[model samples]
Target: MAKEIVCRDAGYDCDFMIRSENEEELIEVVQQHAQETHDTEMSQEDIRGAWKTV
Candidate 1:
């Protein structure tokens, strides 16, 4: 099954959400979103730490 994460649930104010076949892909999408939309940089560990599975 695919996994998902909600940005708000992870403490971000934005409503960014993503789904992927695996954790790595999810993290990649989240990282890209953060960079493009939020002007933020997150490491793999940081993203994983903040993620809330949905």
Candidate 2:
């Protein structure tokens, strides 16, 4: 089953939700979204730390 993480759940005001086949993929997409939308630089550890498996 696919997993998901919501930006709000990560303490962000955005309602962005990333769903993927695995946590790695989900983190990748989230990282890209963070950079493109939020203009924030997040490391793998930051993404993983904020991730809420759903």
Candidate 3:
């Protein structure tokens, strides 16, 4: 099944969503997005916890 992570779901005011069939890829994308766009860096575990499973 495909899974997605929404920035808003992670308590961000932005509406960015990351999707991937792979969990690691999803985390990588979300981590990068959080850093580049939000100026926030997150660990893999934190990233995993922040995203809503969809």
Give Cα-based local distance difference scores for all models.
0.79, 0.79, 0.81
Q: What are the RMSD figures for all models against the true structure?
A: 2.0, 1.8, 1.5
TM-scores of the models, in the order given: 0.71, 0.72, 0.78
Best by lDDT: 3
- Which ranges in model 2 have alpha carbons more than 4 Å from their true place? 1-3
Model 3 lDDT, full chain set: 0.81
How do the residues 9-40 of candidate 3 rate in per-residue lDDT, one tens digit apiece?
A: 77789989877789888888888888999999
Q: Candidate 2 residues 1-54, lDDT tens each?
A: 666778887677998987777777877888899999889988888877776555
Candidate 3's TM-score: 0.78
Ranking by TM-score: 3, 2, 1
Best by TM-score: 3
lDDT tens per residue, model 1, 1-54: 666777787667988788777888888888899899888898998877776555
Model 2 sits at a Cα RMSD from the real structure of 1.8
Colliding pairs, model 2? none
Off by over 4 Å in 3: none
